[model samples]
Target: MGSVEESPEEFTVLVTGFAPFKSEYPVNPSWEIASRLPEYLPRKDSSSSTLPRVRIVVYPEPVRVNYQTVRKLIPTLWGPNDPKINPPPGDTDAGRSFVPPAKIDLLLHIGMAGPRLHYALERVGRRDGYNLRDVDDQLLGDTAADRADPNWVWYGVPAALESDLDLDDVLQRWRAHSTDRDGVNHDLRISVDAGRYLCDFIYTSSLAHLWKQGARRRVAFLHVPAAATPERVAVGQGLVVELVRSLVETEWAARQQAGTDNKTDAKESAAAHVPADGADTVTGKWYRD
Candidate 1:
């Protein structure tokens, strides 16, 4: 077996939000939450070890908000090994030296929705035709397969992909600790629909990409209902932070366990004098939740 690389003291997460697409909605609540989450998220692990950096990407433009954008975005989150995808600008925490690129383990995208006081945890995103239009009256990616890429045509890929998240666990975690100012219980809904617009377009494409990569990475998109009141904002913020924290902690713990298991397996194999194969005995290849 090759040398085992120890787990880093910090683990990274990438959170993203879209910019305002229409004038009627001046502020995207999703952006508001994404912009503020890092401050509220846990910066340390359960053992008080330093947590990895949280990279934030806020797309300021609404143009081409579809699969193509996400195809480009994926490499950035994962760090661009391919030159075609330019990594976003480097981020630096205040007073700290320039931080190196983050090794992302979990990813979350936030988008705004209408006047419902609930979160829609999308179960699946479909590529089936909808002919729905976006803020600019453009046909959503629901029907256009190759609109994002002029040179490539997509024909045989699955029409839909399920979100790789145990949303029930996320909802349960949120309910355990979160409550609205009105004393009414906040609600979470699991649905197949992601609006069949840019939201679904991005979500489906993002998850498909991550799924192809591996199970070690988790991806999900959240639809935040319109937050017109201070109470709503507070609840939304709390919900987002808790869910994110829970997911990150859970992923980190699994990685640690896999590391331990790999070490034990390697020792056992060596004691038994097993012939070595061309494999990293200390590096687990897959994880799921």
Candidate 2:
């Protein structure tokens, strides 16, 4: 009989971007870049079977830039548990049905950064201090009000939650995979603050949801420049592709290390239970018994 080999597991990433932020920004580059992503990660070594098959699943619609809309939408994206929030309807124009992924290896939310000229991977997601109004001119509630409101959605959640992913390792891998274009080296950075806007709100919501569920905080938020030009959008897309690749690679490496450590610990634990050369066993049996 011939030997059989199992295929590599697939790593699924769910990405989302917000809609235009009011009339001033008629076109949001975040959505422009996300909507154009390829279904799968473009691997440099496509023939390598050991590498996980990275699947890129972008949310069907540009998330409305409304605080309430986002607060309702985050849970649905994570799972189909919320009866109040329903899945997006099928796209009649595209002639295809949109089904959300049951399991996501990583949830990546991309939002526009008006003043930033470089790409940033936010390390922290704040639950409070959102004073700015969303596109609908509504506040998420002041810090005091949120804390005082017993019915507040984020009442029990922490003020800030950081992603569990190793940001330092991810950044290194991202930079290595990314290339300079148009005489500009893509300046990738790690940001502690995600800005107290819809970006931070959405990020915090994702982290808190996973926390409440006792799940791994496998989430990330990327901040891209405000420029929505075709050229800029293309660059953003490239950065996102590389960023996804880095995230997957780093996580896989961490898992591999953890598995190794667990095996070593198991061996040590087993050795500790073994009887010494002359010691009697619990069953009253020994080498010379």
Candidate 3:
């Protein structure tokens, strides 16, 4: 009888988007794009069959554009327990709890970039230098005082943290996969600054959480134009799907290379211990014995 072959593992991604910043922008494009994502990533082509199944689990509600709200919510999203965000009023699933996947392999946070025409993948999450007030008219606190305070949320955390995913490799894959699709030219690039707004605050909080846990910072922040038009939302959604695919592909390739290197090192180590004549020098016996 022939042995059975196991299917590839499924990669689970947790996505979140912030609520509207102010009355001027009634609709936040970030949540619009994130909420519209399909449960599973759409296949690019038949050749992608070998890639692991990608499951996208978007947070149930739009995260409030408040500093305190995000600070309290980061742990709930990344911790072992199920998410604790309350469902928005009139939600159909209000009675039943919305439980995300048991294990989340990646986190993607989306935010609005006011007046910007292009999309940007943030490279760094800054812990200090936040001066903007949240929608609720709250500040993260004086940067100097917060750093000096022992009980502050970011007291001991690093001033900046970057994602563990390789941005250069992911960008290359993203450009290749998202090129000229639907005859729409998408502008995507990596940015070192996240504007020190709630976007940066949330990004820093997520990265710091993982840092404290001694875990890989598999987190990404995407800043998209504030346009909430149906056309813009659709385009944003497409870009997000491709970005997720790029991330998964890059990580998969890296793991494969690491495994190959380990095998080669093992072979070289074994060969070194064996004498040139294939005899064990310590026992004067054949290596096969």
Candidate 4:
């Protein structure tokens, strides 16, 4: 535990889990859902104060291997990303020494199957709409969306990636593990085939590290089951810490509403690319909702 450096306001979320290739009492459920995610998080400070920091960096279980061996399996939880932790530097205004040389945005990848989950925990087959063309393949798609079905996949934040927190006060603080609305996981339903293996090798290799290694930071993949008894693996590890905090607060409120609609379409395309007195004020507001 030495190289601890990261900041971009404080981030990192690469949780992963999966190892018993075919089970035999090896404690699975995606390492109890990446050991319950929550190193710290408060946000709000720009003098607006409330701060708290330590955004998140819960590791353990990307087993069938390779995330550049994730800094050789947790290099003090990896780092590199800190645009001066909001004015944090030289000495110590301290957002933990504003380091962040790599922020480490996202990479979920959880696992556990028994009823029917195929497509890439190295079983191959879910190419394009999120990868798995290898690792043994298996995600033939179509497993029925319906989690109220607003949307399910498509990321981009830096692979891509936030905070205030609300939405039904955060889905009633964990819709009881989508256990069909709290019957205590209604006997754990099983049938998730998203494909490629470690949940499609952590969502098609973190979107192949942003369309393939350019990894700018967002990545995902999840699958869970096997707790009918065995004392319900601590009720499936308290509903996998409320489904990994509702999948990181539903992707941090869709990347803060797509970064406020791309900064209101880049300030109306820089005021329609400059004009007013110089000759360029053309207007055409055509929003249809």
Which candidate has the top score in TM-score? 3
lDDT of each: 0.55, 0.75, 0.75, 0.40
Query: What is the Cα root-mean-square deviation between model 4 and the actual structure?
Result: 21.8
Off by over 4 Å in 3: 1-8, 82-96, 142-145, 148-150, 263-289
Provide TM-scores for the models. Answer: 0.66, 0.80, 0.80, 0.26
lDDT of 2 by residue, 143-170 (tens): 6767768777777777777676776677
| Candidate 2 residue-wise lDDT at 135 | 82
Instruction: Count clashing residue pairs in model 4.
Output: 43
- What stretches of model 2 exceed 4 Å from their correct place? 1-8, 46-49, 81-97, 142-151, 180-184, 263-289
Clashing pairs in 3: none
Task: Give the alpha carbon lDDT tens digit for every residue of 1-289 in model 1.
Answer: 1111223644555566765665776777776776666533554335424345433333332223444555455555554444665644322231022222345556777888866767866656665565666555655343354645645333444566665444545555455545522355767655556776777776766666655555432667888987635666667777777667656555555456669787421112222322122211222311111
**Model 3: lDDT to the true structure:** 0.75
Query: Tens digits of per-residue lDDT for model 3 on 183-260?
Result: 555777777678889998889899998888778788899999999999989989999998989888877676677697
Candidate 2 Cα lDDT to native:
0.75
Q: Which stretches of candidate 1 lie over 4 Å from their true place?
A: 1-7, 22-24, 43-71, 87-101, 140-156, 179-184, 214-217, 229-231, 253-289
2 or 3, greater by TM-score: 3
Q: Candidate 2: deviation at residue 14, Å? A: 0.3
Residues 1-289, model 4: lDDT tens digits: 2234566675455565655555363566566545555565433225313222435554432354332232122222232333322322111132223332355655555676655422111212132343333233443342344223445332232212111122223343345434543565333221223443445434444443345234333444545664434455555555555544554555555566669787421112221322212121124521101
Ranking by TM-score: 3, 2, 1, 4
